[model samples]
Target chain A: MIDVFLDNGPAYLAGFRMTLALTAVAGVASLVFGTILAALRVAPLRPLRVLATGYVELLRNTPLTLVFFGMVLVAPQFGIIPPIGFWTAIICLTLYTSAFVCEALRSGINSVGVGQAEAARAIGLTFGQSLALVIFPQAVRTVIPPLINVIIALAKNTSVAAGFAVVELVATGRRLGQAIPGEAVTILGGIAILYLLFTIPAGLFATRIEQKVAFAR
Target chain B: MRTRMTRAAALGAVALLALGACASNGGGDGAADVDAGDFPEGSTMARLADAGSIKIGTKFDQPLFGLVGPNGVPEGFDVEIGKLVAGELGIDEGDIEWIETVSSVREDSIANGTVDIIVATYTINDTRKEKVSFAGPYYLAGQSLLTLKTNTDIQGVDDIGGMKICTASGSTPEQNLLENYPDAEVVPFGQYSDCLEPLRNNQVHAISTDNVILAGFAAEHDDLEVRGEQFTEEPYGIGLAKDDTDFRNFINDVLEKIFEDGRWVEAWEATAGTVLPTPEPPTIDRY
Candidate 1:
């Protein structure tokens, strides 16, 4: 096991790094985009709400692999070539993950009391102001755990990029496994451990944040 | 209860008859009349001959080499070669169990004894020889490029510098690009077919792999054409468990027999020869 790591340290590290980069970029982008979509779902404009709802329904219902296929294979026919490697994977993951994130945030937004929205409206606050200030603050606190879960899922979903040409952790493991068939078990176990290193820490951090924001209702 | 038992026995008999018919229909017309008694005692050939069955591994997706035919059995040059070897062991085509061994798992499959032999257009390299012994580079392929018909930019390997070349992951071509052509951007996919869409979409500049495999793809699609002469010599070999000299020699001998008897030419003409002219038979390295 140790020899496996020692021999293929650079490859394992490079793959781990790529996974981290993908997760980090996609995670942050989806959080931002999903929050906006969530806001749109709860907005006063009917068309915006319908559009956001349609996007979430369509994307979240579709398989991630199909989404990747569309982005890599289908999208290019229309001249929407997104540079094929890292960015393409980033776009696919974000598109797929943001929908789940949108639903999670929308649920959190709905969890906020109707009275709070009415109270903000009773004042001079507009829709955007109420969402950004009164509603979003509370919604974010409630949604952190679920939102982190989505991000964690996104991290694992980066494996799909392996098929499309991005040499992420799983692809790296596969390459290493092929190069040294004898050490496949050790290489795969090491990859699993590397994934945990990201996910477990993020889970614990979410827990810490959740406890920190645990206010008496 | 007696009537029901009689009905069940009749159904079982019908099923057995149907299976027998299917088996006879599916068996290819290449079973050799080798005497099992000719092999020395305790040898792999004698053991396999006694058992009257052999498990062969090959690629199911590679078109000219080992594509799965409409009858659900794989039919290609490699598969035909497999049948010839099995026939020498007194095993019929129906008794040869075909296992799909993709590029990456060929070594592992042989090492773990999941396959008696592999004829998956397997490229013989020193790295693989450490894990599994190889026999009869029965065919010699070379690393080449496949591009769109209209594309005039990449004519050969020299034009591939700084271009995106898609190839199967964990394959010799991928390694070749990574090692030899450092300037070329290597895009590795799970299978050669997986690269086709990307190549068609212009995401990859060209597809690079074995010339025969490229020819297989080109034969399937009108738009794609194989470009550039073969850059690297890829000796296609039969993979088996390492250090099994008896089995290796037996397979080599079978290959030599087929080469002389014109059975190899017939197999090639019926499969890969549709798209490629049959070349000189590669020398069997009896190492």
Candidate 2:
């Protein structure tokens, strides 16, 4: 209805850029960090496994809203003072998303048969070598779908960063809707469509990957 | 299995039809009475009263405007206004249900029926009037900066060039800085509460928002203070669905009454005086 964004396109676009950046950073960080935590989770040593387990459980159990609140509230106390919207959302989302990623990858690692590791060891490979050459490759293929799911989830969760003033999609919509009186539904709907433009394709891709993995099995 | 699927479809159809019926045939005469014949037939308030109680949205973090007090009860100026609006409708303040809104959810909360009205510190701007209706210039505020008491480098809005300033999303401060101070960098957080903690730790050079809200930070941390004159004029108002002219008129009338009867002054004094300098009361000048 009312096209307020047309008048304030620059501000909305600025917010959109921040949203995209935050999501990309969180997605990548979660993937890399979670992979390490998953490997640690699947490690044979009890202490290493315990440390990974603790991180997963603690992060998973806490609400992301609280985590974000903590990030804005507590992160600075730790000397991690992000000087711009760019770093605060990325760093906080990285921490929040990594917890879920670790769990997802750990499950993926579990799906990888132990016999592969055993075969690597039998062939005279070291533990790290066995994991890199045998276990990790197999685990990655198995976890692709779920990891994609997490990526989509992380993308959606990036909207929460708007609360911290991260210029993401939802915040953009909020600004537009507030700017226009009679067009909130239209404005918010446009935002939802934008989010779907990103997420629906990701969900479909993940589903397709799952189908392929299932077919392989 | 096919029969079950058909049944589910039928149920969904029924729900849709019910919603359509509610939308079309709803809105009793209460809101129409307030509209002074300016509103179209069947406004949001009439429909809401047909269902009972105005569902107002507000923040749970902004201290004096809208926030959860130490007792974990929602209390603040905006919260009080939400109650008073409902009371003017002859509904009890307790009957006025609250929908918790953050900076990101305020607009959608109204559009989606999550709230029938928004009493958040929502600025009524030309851009905002397109999507939702605003009742009055309920409060007059300005964008300003807050910094740690010990910091000396930044004096006001001007010194923040290339410095990190903390703000929340969907706020005017971010827009003001980028437009006026192109050299300044902004760090956005989800809530106003987030900005101050970072300020306390020196993570940011300054915190920017309405001077009134920054006053809350000043009250909380004796180390913080509002610096410089009020930089930008920000007029706060209540938000309702754009189609809800009946509801909007009723709200405007209530605002007018409060502004004149001195009750509004008492409310302002009881709440805003601690963080803000005692000033002349705001008048309802809704066009």
Candidate 3:
């Protein structure tokens, strides 16, 4: 088993690198777009809020695998051919995760009292200015934990791309585990540890931020 | 808080141990120690005879090769051969237990006594020979390609470079294609059946596996076809425990009879034979 790991470690690492790259790209894309959607939901315009709500509710209800399936089957019909497996998977991850991130941020926005939005408006600030300067700064600190959770979810969901032929961490582990008989238990254990190496840091970093911010009840 | 943590840890450990005690895991348990006196003298064949049934392992996914049918019974070329082996061993067909062993667990299933023999479309190779003994290279299957009916671009292996190809996960074809076509993208799926959709949708350029499996797909769908000559030689072998030399010999003898008496050709006409003609059965190598 050790020999298999030693011999195959580089391929596994290469696959892991692809997983991390996809997660990072998808994570940032989702955060930016999701934050925008969340802001739109809390905006003064009724139409913007309805659109944001619909986007989040529709995507969040669907399975991540089905979303990728649609990307392969439906996207091609639109003449939108994603160049490679990486982009296809990343695009799917971005769209699916943005919905959840939107909800998490919007929930944090709800927690901020309506009075805060009113106070900013009273100062003769536009709705956008009140959101960017007053409402968002406070809501972000509270939503950091949920944002981290979303990132963790994104990291794991990248494995679904393996079904569509993207060689990521879990897919690499699976190929190796299946090729090398009787060592599956050990190989899977190793793969699980590699996953922890990713997720544990996100968690620990969240704890540190929670401690540093120390928001009052 | 520290004392509470310690108590929870201790409680968790106890629960884990309790769960472990009840688990009959792979390569470790479930194979009972049969009384030596019950067997006919010293032969391993005695164990199968005394057990009243033999456990035969094969695949549960590959259509016409070794798939579980709509009625929940495993039907395929491998199944027919398994039945032939069971009948020759003085065991009734109903007494045979069919276990599904994927390529990964083919050797482990035999070593652990999960199966008396594996008739899965298992290829005979050097690396696997170290783990288990193979008898009667019953049939030879070659790696081939399955593509959309409209795919004129990828007629053979050479044209696959720079195109995405999907093979069954954990099988040899994935690595072989990757190594041969440095520019081609290879995807591994859990089952050969899973590769069909991606190929049909053009998410993948093609599906690659043993020709026998690809032929089944070609027969099922008018939209797919098995193209290109056999690119690689894959001799299908019957797997037996490493220690069971007598049992291995007995299987080879049965295989020879099947070939001589025309049952082998007859079995072929029924399953994978519907799509592919009967090729020469592989020579049984005692080694």
Candidate 4:
């Protein structure tokens, strides 16, 4: 088992690097894209709110694997050639996770009392300014916990990328397990450790920031 | 809150460590259960005979080879072969335990006693010999190219230059194809079925897998055809534990009996012959 670890350490590291890069890219993209959707969901216009609501409801209700299969299998009929494994996973991850992230931020926006938005309007701010300036800061504390949860979910969800044949951490671990027989536990455990080593720290940082800027309530 | 979170994290880490310890222990010492009950000693066959049942593993996906039937039972050429082997061991076919062994975990399943044998479309190779012994190269197959029905240019592997070629992940064919066609964009999927969509849509120019598997797919889809002659030979071997030489030899003898009695041909005709022409069975490599 130790031999499996020693032999595949570099491969596992490479896979971990890929996983981290995937998580980073998806995390940032989802945050940006999701924020826009959240803004749309809460906008005064009913059509924008319905459209955002439709997207979030549709994606959140569907399984991620099915979404991936649909994109790869069905997209070709429409002449959209999805990229190979890595980029395919990134696209699916961004699309799926943005829905959840949008919901989180929307709930956070709601948690900021209506009085805050009224105050923004009292200061002669427009709809965008009101969100960008007053309500968003207060909403951050409410969003932190669920946002962190979504981030963790997104990171772990990268495991499904293995189905598409990307050599991410789980797939690397699987290949190592196959190469060095009878080390399924060691290979999988090592992968879990590598994931925790980084993800736990990220979670801790989120918690720290959450505390420092915690809402008075 | 900090203490609770810290304690939870510590608990999780410790639990994971404990699981790892248990598995490593299983790998080292707990794998000797073949010696537990015995009508006679010195051979896995005798032990299995005493145990009165045998667990057989085969692929649960490949159609006409090892797929589960409409009845929710494993029914294919490999499954029938497993049934025959179980019957020879004095175990009734109904009593046989069918385990699904994917390509990558064949060795591990043998080592851990998850299955007494694997009959998946397992290609025998030297790299695998270090971990598990093989018996009875019962089926002869070869790597073949699969292309959309409209393709005319890709008659062989040489035409895959700069083509987007796909194969099942973790398969030797994938390794061979990637090594030979360095310029081809290699796309791999976990299951052979996953590759079909991309091929149908022309997202990938070609699919390469064992002829046996490709034949099954081609039979199912009118718009898909297996093109070219075989590029490489792959002998399908029955995998067993490395130390189980007696059992391996016994399996080889059973395979020989089936071949001699025409049961092998009958089994193939019942399943794969629906799509594939009859081919001579590969001879065994006794170790």
Q: Could you give candidate 4's per-residue lDDT for residues A137-165 as a string of tens digits?
A: 78867889789989999999998887885
Between candidates 2 and 4, the one scoring higher on lDDT is 4
Residue B201 displacement (Å), model 2: 2.1
CA shift of A55, model 4, Å: 1.8
Error of 1 at B31 (Å): 8.8
* Candidate 1: pairs in clash: none
* Candidate 2 C-alpha lDDT tens digits along B1-287: 99998988887688678657645654421132242133334765555555557787898888778887544557778887777676555454545787788877777787887888898889888767888889987888898889887888888877888888888765667667766887987776666677777777766789888887898788778898777777888788889888566677878888888788776777777776666765565667566
Winner on TM-score between 2 and 4 is 4
RMSD to the true structure for each prediction, in A, is 7.8, 14.0, 13.2, 14.2
lDDT of every model, 2 decimals: 0.89, 0.75, 0.83, 0.83
Off by over 4 Å in 2: A2-14, A80-84, A207-217, B1-141, B157-163, B172-186, B232-287
lDDT of 3 at B192: 77
Candidate 3 chain B: worst-modelled 10 consecutive residues by lDDT: B24-33
Error of 1 at B100 (Å): 7.8
Model 3, span B143-234: residue lDDT tens: 88889989999888878888888886567787677667778778776567877766776778988877887898898899998878778888
Over B114-137, each residue of candidate 1 has an lDDT whose tens digit, in order, gives 989999989888988899999998
DockQ for candidate 4, C-alpha atoms: 0.24
Chain B TM-scores, listed for every candidate in order, come to 0.77, 0.68, 0.73, 0.73
Q: What is the lDDT of residue B277 in candidate 1?
A: 56
Better of 3 and 4 by TM-score: 3
The candidates' interface RMSDs, in order, read: 1.7, 2.8, 2.9, 2.2
